[model samples]
Target chain A: MDARSPKRGRRRHGRFDVLWFLGVPILLIVAVEIVPMLGVVWISLTDYNPLEPDSWLSFVGGENYSRMLGDDLFWQSLLNTSYFALLYLPIAIFGAMVAAILLNQQLRGRLVFRGIFFMPVVVSWVVGSTMIMWFLDPSSGLPSMISESLGFGRLPQLLQDESTAMPTVAFVAIWKYFGYNTVIYLAGLQAIDSALDEAAKVDGASALRRFWHITLPGLRPVTAVVVMLNMIQAMRIFDPMMIMTNGGPNNSTTSTVLYVYRMAWDNLQFGYGSAITAVLSVIIFAIAGLQFWFFNRRSVER
Target chain B: MSVEAKHVQTPSRGAAGEGRLGKVVTYGLLSVGALVILGPFLWMVRSVVTPNEVLYSDSGGGIIPRQFTLDHIKDAFTAGVQPFDVYFVNSLIVTVIAVVSNVIFCGLAGFALARIEFVGRRAVTVVIVLMLAIPIESRIIPLYILASRSGLSNSYFGIALPLLVTSMGIFLMRQYVMTIPRELDEAAKVDGCSSWRLYWKIIFPICRPVIAAIAIFTFITAWNDYMWPLVIIQSQDMQTLPVAVGNMAVVKDQLRWGTLLAFSLLSVTPVLVFYLFLQRQFMAGITSGAVKG
Candidate 1:
């Protein structure tokens, strides 16, 4: 019995060692990510407010979701987020593609130019937003100064004005990410065989013709990645809008994530906030799934 | 003869050279693009050094500032609700702890997934990838509740906990660990090394590059993180640099442009400098992470 028990204990020790390696991370992911996700789902069904310590566990089913259905501000914010994404996706994709092609050339100082372009990606979003705020400030901003010198009047306050705030924010978002996309596309570009371009040239094809027929098609996979990532990222736009406009000038720039922040923290409406979060999460997942399926199918067909 | 020479030059230029004019155009376009990209940062640096009054003056808005002063830098460090030093320190503490936790926990987790034979390893990897799809912002509400419920809110641990074991870090480490030879493990085991010792002595030391990548990425993400920190940390004293700078902008009655610029500069300098030195590794980390994902 003593020998048998010792062997059994050794077996148990081996199992325990495996758990020791995997346990902490699994527990962390459960505690931090998965559990919170489930909690968010549960919280959406309740009207519990943390500020009121006594009523922390109260439940009200479907009311927050129903309220969100009737909330114009909620819809407006969602639309604003979509608008920002639509504006950003095309510019980011096209600009990154073009810039990547340019930088991929065998120019004398291309590396220096690549570094200069990629500077904004390394800068923090908060800092970039602040810099944008200052640079577009009507009183003494560079844009305003340039406009005045060029015989144009003082430029409009882009951030404060409702008509331009979202687009302005979108532009800054594009600028911040353009370099990152450029680098990714450059990676894609470099992977393409130079022989393909050479063959097209041998066929008496012009540079534009070669680019249109050969280069663009070769970039399909990378383009799919860039587009999917950009769309998902743009949909979750929060930091720039939160920092720059605070969803202001008539709620023009209030992204859905920012609205979630406002609902939960600013107003202490945890139920409503989680309701929006639940819905937004589903929508984001759906979009990502659709992109994945589309990309996967295309690649499979190719 | 001249016509034939011109014809030959034209075809060769079209094939390879793109000509002097083409070179001129390419350089011009690249220069303009660079200017657009770096223009705001230059303006930011100018505002940091330029006096506030001059920054506001119509004629004083140029790439180069005429008057220079350190008053704004001084004010940035000294003149806030909680001074900038406190914010810097808070950010430093949170980021340091986060980096350490990520390296250790993710290193262990990654080694197991890559090398150890265990049940549910596949399930764990699948879970990690799935978690990557869940945006942190969507989970922030419940995370905040969890932190508050556990009495972790407003503490350094609370700020760093959610970020301690990022899925990307685990995935990165696993990929790096998988590239290390299996023979090393066998060699270590032959010398009386246990699994834990194999991981610690053999695996960990060889993973300096991946560890460096994880450390840099985590440091930058933690330092620049605004939303989660804003939600979790409510105290004036516990605020990180981004949160502090954001609050300073909103709460302060007078927007001190120079001071704000200086503060922005201070917040960005560390990561920017780190990025410059380790640019290749940073880019490799990003690209490799994306490709693997």
Candidate 2:
């Protein structure tokens, strides 16, 4: 594109007028993403607290970083966030692939089923988390009702139990997010050269064999995308913990983002919050880069 | 590059779908998945119609309500945890305005990036891509500080500002615009079209598919956004639906479940409406934006 564009030179009325087009977007990006990003990095280094006087906002170097390292909750939240990513990644990627494959099968009312599956993708995590909290509430909710109906006593609290909370939250999160990966996989499925599968079939290849070689390999790009974005989102998870558990039942569900929000807003520990944010930003960038490179290399090797 | 609407409209390969047993298995599995997916949302609708007493009563064998009532739904507006109507209007205003700005700004920017030869063009693209890599949640602290400092806090513009023009929208438009033949620009220029006119007339009209993609994506993102609105909006009246309704997180009494459930249903209504009206667009837009990107 670089070589061809210069050779084929896009002529116009001096093209300078178009610079303003770039101007507005660039301005907004700088203000919203760029400025705040720099601010976050700066604030992370200090002991700034909104409630405190300006004197308290003095630069404290890497004190916030050392504090974060010493903080037990920071480590706990990091682990919880990592746990969430581990729980979310495989199930989400695999489930979406299966759902996509299922939807691709010629079935009655496939479009309606597509809508049914994709319903969660449109819903906010707020709506999802709020509804899931009630729907999964221990005693008076659906779980207990069904348990009692089956001659078992009331079901144990799902969200209230420390052991079950993270898994429960991750499940609901998966329910809300899997639809997106499914759509992506469906698109990837459609994008595959169907003639390969058809030819494989004509060669008497079994459905499993065809799917294993022709389908799965063909889906590498979307798979890379799905896995990378899903992991990043899971690591930065907030709504599930914030709305559902409030990082409670022994703070088991306290994800890193929820921890950041807690420190920054709830506890007014702005510096520590920004420190965590800076760390998270770097981690997200690293994961994204690794995944992109990994996927590109795989594609090149193939 | 998207191949969204046309390809999804027909299954290009469905050899297994042709088998009789495969049809049964497919429908059966899809039905189970559908049941699991739709269960909570359906229960939400059911709870919305059920009165508080019935919702709390032992007579209910399931989350299903034996009787239906509109009282809870009505209370969602009047007896909200926050100023429900105000939040609804705020979300509506913020979402609509943000979506409009996304289209205009991203349209111009996308066209510029794709077609116009300009300085810092590649740099802008790199920056947007890098922005996309950074998670929004990680940046909320500084976003809040900026919002408050700029006096956008507790204001609709504040709520909408950060999201007004998205990196995804810009990238979606840029990718789509790249597909537009340079001849369109050439011919338009030769036919007395200025740069702005070339964009407004030639590129803009041709970019409707991606525009639909951008519009729907931006609308959903803005409408469904919670973290930013939760951070920026300070006043009770300024809360968006998600923040407002979501704060009703604790219906610990179980009897108060109906109202919160009603609020949940209320907050989700607009999104459901979008899904119903533009079902394919939702699938196509999301598929292309994520997959192609």
| Count of clashes, each model | 0, 0
What docking grade applies to model 1?
acceptable
Residue pairs of candidate 1 with colliding backbone atoms: none
In the range A1-302, model 2's lDDT, one tens digit per residue, is: 33555633445657568666777888888888888888888888788877665723589999989998789999999999998888888888898898898888656688888888889989988888877776776555576677777889777778888888898888888889888888888888888987677667669888888888988888888888988888888878988788888888898888889889888888998988999999988888889999989988987997
lDDT of 2 by residue, B139-195 (tens): 788788777876888888999987788888888899889888877777676677788
**Which one is best on TM-score?**
2
In candidate 1, position B105 carries an lDDT of 90
User: Estimated TM-score per prediction?
Assistant: 0.92, 0.93
Instruction: Give candidates' CA RMSD values in order.
Output: 5.3, 3.8
Q: For candidate 2, what is the interface RMSD?
A: 2.9
| Candidate 1 lDDT over residue span A167-282, tens digit each | 99998898888888888998888777766676567688987787788788889889888877887788789999888889988999999999999988989999899999999989
lDDT of 2 at A53: 50
lDDT score at residue A169, model 2, on the 0-100 scale:
89
- Runs of candidate 1 exceeding 4 Å displacement: A1-13, A54-56, B1-17, B58-63, B251-255
Full-model lDDT for every candidate: 0.82, 0.81
At residue A264, candidate 1 shows an lDDT of 88
